[model samples]
Target: MEWTQILTLAAKEFRDRMRNRWVLAVALVFTVFSLVIAYFGGAQQGAVGFRSIEFTIASLVSLVIYLIPLIALLLGFDAIVGERERGSLDLLLSLPITRLELLLGKYLGLAAALTLSTLAGFGLVALLLWQRIDTAGLYHYAGFMLSSVLLGLAFLSLAVLVSVVARDRTRASGLAIALWFFFVLVFDLLLLGVLVGTGGRFGGEAFAWLLLLSPADVFRLLNVFSLDDVRTLYGLASIVPTSLGSPGVMGGVMLAWIALPLVVARWRFK
Candidate 1:
């Protein structure tokens, strides 16, 4: 792919996204939400003299993991198919640009938009926590936020892939939204079912592999695993060893999911 063409297309799409009020509006709402959640969680939890910043950041991370992924889906669910529905994709594709270039451009542009918004939320949360009180594990909290932000990118890539494959905006939006629900919401319910049916007992590596199949679980594992002492001492769902193959392994799994769907989408688009 030509860097010139890719960057040109990326710039154009970036401008389009910036002009789109929905993107900015969503980001604004999310930023405020982060501030509110962090403040209250810190004030309420830490005032009993517990380190409120830690709980505040942890709660914010869980909220980020779920909502950021959904935002990624909502913003990107119609990237290409929406153009087709509005009767513009044919005209756009008819230009001098190659499909590969279009794919790379749109992905980079849309992903960058999502990244900017996600970082805005993280920045606000970090700022709030930094000013209020001294937290013990600041680096760990930052790690959790950074990891969740990347995981959000993975979700955006998934939505972009879906957008490219669908024939029109409505179908693309429906499928992409469905996928977000399945992976983020329903998949967790399914895991809970398995845990319940088996009496919440984990035997071996198969359980680890099953948990790895879920982007949500991989994310939760990262957020929770870092607090091993917290998990052991608190006993908050620590029984079923989420002791996955380290943070790197989970990161690799999330990245693979992000790449695989786009590769399939490109082939389908071709």
Candidate 2:
């Protein structure tokens, strides 16, 4: 539809984000946290004679799993709802732009920022690692960074969808935070309990499905790039079991997850 309008609004949204001091602080915190984890974890692995590839994979996966969803939640949960609460959303809606443009522009802005941040962070880590050690893993690790960034955008869209429905920042933030906690922290624990209580009976099929439900696990699968390792680690699924699927299939699923929500959010626009 209005590509120019959408792009312009998206640019404005990106600029407006500069005024969001809290988000700036959070982004800084995320950067610091990733650096600390990477440095310390990489050092420990290097000392233990673990390969650089393994260290990078583990470090990046852990960082993205723990932090990305939180970042997405914080950034998106208040997207529309916050504006509505502040009386600015009404003014914006009163403008010439349609609701679809509003939603699309915000999503594009969030997605662009998320992508840029991950790419920049990965570049820094790659530079540091190159100075420290060389590994064939760099190539795969690059792919991991790219896929993880897309997955992070999926979570951002999920939060945006919540923001749209709730139409109030407080309620949407509460829901976003609660869901983040559930998926990040509690979901796996609950799954573990179920697996144990069932004497591991439900674990095989259930945990497989859990990957579909939990974005965190899907991200982990993306990191499992080596096919031999996928088989050794994932079993006889032919589709890279421990992973979400093979790289090709995994990419499709992750994109679907991201796109489906943005579509819904767009369609539901007033």
Indicate the worst ten consecutive residues by lDDT in candidate 1.
230-239
Work out the TM-score per prediction: 0.85, 0.84
Which TM-score value belongs to model 1? 0.85
Worst ten in a row by lDDT for model 2:
231-240
Runs of candidate 1 exceeding 4 Å displacement = 42-50, 132-136, 198-205, 229-245
- Candidate 2 local lDDT, 102-159, one digit each (tens): 8989988877777766666666666656755456567676777788788788899898
lDDT of 1: 0.73
Model 1 residue 81 lDDT score: 83
Residue-wise lDDT of candidate 1 within 100-140, one digit each (tens)?
Answer: 88888888888777777766766665665575555656677
